[model samples]
Target chain A: MQFIVEDVVTHLAVKVTEPRIDAAIATPFKDKLREIVVKSRKPIHLDMASVDFMDSSGLGAMIAVRKSLPQNLGMVLCALTPNVERVFRLTRMDSVFDIRPLTAQKEHRE
Target chain B: MTPIERSEPKRSTRASAQVQPMFHRVLSAQPETVRDTLQDVRRRFQGEVSDDTLGRLELVLAEVMNNVAEHAPAGAGAPDDSVRLPVIHLCIVRHTNGLACALTDDGVSLPDECILPRSLPALVMDDLPEGGFGWFLIQDLTQALCYYRESQRNYLAFSIPFAQSGAA
Candidate 1:
């Protein structure tokens, strides 16, 4: 899986285009996220609209990215597809992250 | 040609019953091909599966096929050096109560240390997110799941209760 990082205002938006985010491809995705966070400003938004599947591996990577951000300035938000959203709901991680609708302003900002 | 005499042999054959018909198929390991194969299976079965069961079947099949593409050994110049082209072996068995599916592939077996936990909390807390949950979900959704390794092949089997209790 490859994640494309785009800088929107001061916040970084990361888009995951892969359909499956499980153990098989988690490491590459996490590595790319780490690379992006190191150079990003603050308030990262993860656009998971194209991601149809996410297992624990993907969730762990998201959490790791959240933790790697600057403590005071870092915020992580999720834009989940309906199917992927179900996974978040099932795992109750929706409560931890600032999950917004796919079409919400934060997600639509390109 | 008496009606009673002719029907007696037919009735006895039905009662004795030969071996149940078995179905098997092998398909390419491409991700796109997986969906087509699934659709074909559903069509061939004539919508025998309820909606809920169909959803579960799709999820489980996707999980296993994804694993095959990621973990199996790859041949030279394979699309992704990740795994050689995987040979997926699928078998469906019909029993009195339900249908059983056994999917076999030439991929690495589940790691010895990665036994699925018996409880959901253990799965949520002990397993780090972004990994180690596919098998857990498969176990939770299916009626039964088992894994075995023989020679160089990995066999994963799962079954669902098919006798309809009510509408899905």
Candidate 2:
């Protein structure tokens, strides 16, 4: 799995190229995201279109990313594929983050 | 009058000697490869199980493999580095009436003090703030689940009962 990091104004958009975002791959991704959050001054958008599955560890990673950012300075957005979306819903994490549909417009226009 | 004596039937003590097909492999601990392996396992064992059973098995395997990949031993470089050598060992055993799987990794074992909470649904739904729900799910779904740490390896095993079609 590959993680592409892009900076957008005050917010950061991370594109995860992995097919699954469960426990096996969540740690490295979480660490990368945390590194990004520590350096960025804006919200973080996790684009997970390529992620077909996400278990609890993946969810925990997201939560950890959310916590790593400065309070009131960082927000977390998730764009999840259908299967991954199902997991988020199953875990009721759908209400925790700004979860965008996989088909939603990208954060950057260009 | 003639008396007739009868002997009590002897019960077999051994587990049914049914031929259980076994499939096992140690694959790259890459998150991207898990789905393909799962699909192959399902396809090969299709008619013998139900969709729900397959889904449960897949979920368990995914969680375990994901744990191995993310936490397995390797210098922190990239996700690919996690699968350097002997990082993951997975086995799927199917019997005439049950299915079992074990996934092992050479990563740091789960902490001894870190108790996997029972309130996973509450944690996920209510944002209760704690983690380790994957362990919970693995324990919840399978009939038998255990975690063993041997030296540097963490082994997670799970099994479920296989429903038989009819009586012989």
Candidate 3:
């Protein structure tokens, strides 16, 4: 349930530190991410590199956060593990959000 | 007896045999416990099953178990001191083709629509759906999905097939 937000100028780069986002943390996870994105009011670049697993509830949370933002604002999901990515791909939510491959930043960071 | 008939008896007795990698648990229908069981199930069959199959297996189990937890009987759960968490009995056994799973729970009866063939929820971008994907995902990834209610408990069974190797 921890997020590391960095203001990368054009977009707010937010990294999810949690390994799994399931029913256990979906509500709080949504609430926290919603607050962060709403306050910043910038397009988001979400780093899902640490997350190894996510269920439908977790996907719902991500969708809720995306819906919370202004229509013009964007959220790009990156570095999704295979398990986490399947939920999005199977549900066809991958079409709704901007998904990117793992960036060089992840390799640089500890 | 044919070879198939010879092995059928042995495989049916998998519960008592150590040859098959199996998992069985009696846990309350709660988010935390369900999560724990999934992790352990993954560990129990880590190298035995491919990662692709394991991922599918985990996601499907999460949806079914959490659905039970979410629909806990009215006045039966949460902050109240007299809380009675629905108890779920889960079992998984690996076969040549796929992993077979069966779950029985004392939670509220499952709706008829769940086991029926279902499509994904309609996509609305402006007001994107936040839910309703659970059952669809469950049905989409499982085979021979079946459900029946007997007296006070609901029984569910399904299988996740092994991954098709080296398919590009």
Candidate 4:
């Protein structure tokens, strides 16, 4: 489990370097992410672009990390790959997490 | 979306017209092994199946095999408290309309409640459920999910339908 944590303008920006978050490493992923997010009292932006696969255990880990944070604080998952996004969407966890696309700019038609 | 088809015992698909890609592996019911097997499975059907169908197939297989790993009983005859992992026999074959999958293992018998109709865990914002999504995803993505215990081995079968032309 590797996360590149940086102090962005208002919150911690984390880049998840792992490609897969299945049962093999879900526990460690949760522990390490929780430690990083709770150390500072700010919002979080998790860049999940690199993760190509995630299962139910991985979903549980994400939920665990979200629950670990203070209720007032927020964690945003950004750039979720299709496979990873499917788990969240199937389980209805999409509503609970503040998911976002990578860029802030609007999509202008060609 | 495909309707759930009731599983037929000892049947995967009607006789196939063309030879399709197939994968078979016998591995321990451990997380690391499960990951490796799933990766290999993806490789076996990379060009043969669409991405949508492949993704669904992978997710369903992961949930089933990992359940075997997670619920493994303690080492049956070990002197020490070493955990004993079940051995999973997995087979997947491509059919004309879907991918047929079958898995057999001698592990803790699946409780009656697992295969019963299930819904997502109650979505309580303050105390969200951490688990219980595995079986739900399996049931949702696969068609004809059937499970039966014969003697000590548990037999399970299902099929993942090919993605519709433009149903998204």
Note the Cα lDDT for every prediction shown.
0.64, 0.67, 0.90, 0.90
lDDT of 4 at B110: 92
What would the per-residue lDDT of candidate 2 be over residues B69-142, giving only the tens digit for each residue? 66645654465665364467778888655688877877676775333435454654323453756766666556
lDDT of 1 by residue, B1-168 (tens): 556875664556664685553457897665556556665665555466565455455556666776666565546226677545667898876566566889887766768543455433333422335445566556655666788889877788877566435422
Provide the TM-score for each candidate, comma-separated. 0.58, 0.54, 0.89, 0.89
Local lDDT at B128 for model 4: 96
Worst 10 residues of 2 chain B by lDDT: B159-168
lDDT of 3 at B63: 98
Model 4 C-alpha lDDT per residue in residues A24-95, reported as the tens digit of each score: 999999999999988877899999989999999999999999999976999899988889988998899999
Once fitted onto the true fold, the runs of candidate 1 whose alpha carbons sit more than 4 angstroms away are: A1-10, A19-25, A73-77, A103-110, B1-59, B65-87, B91-100, B106-117, B120-130, B148-153, B160-168
- Model 2 C-alpha lDDT per residue in residues A1-110, reported as the tens digit of each score: 46798887757788878776665567897887787777777777777767756677777887887777776664555665555654555556667767765435645222
Q: Cα RMSD to native, each candidate?
A: 7.5, 10.8, 5.7, 7.8
The order by descending TM-score is: 4, 3, 1, 2
Q: Tens digits of per-residue lDDT for model 3 on B17-79?
A: 656788999999889999999999999999999999999999999999999999986666668
**Candidate 4: true contacts recovered, fraction:** 0.91
Arrange candidates by lDDT, highest first: which order?
3, 4, 2, 1
Q: Give candidate 3's error at residue B144 in angstroms.
A: 0.6
lDDT of 1: 0.64
Per-model i-RMS in Å? 4.6, 3.8, 0.5, 0.4
The order by descending DockQ is: 3, 4, 1, 2
Model 2, CA-based lDDT: 0.67
- Which CAPRI tier for candidate 3? high
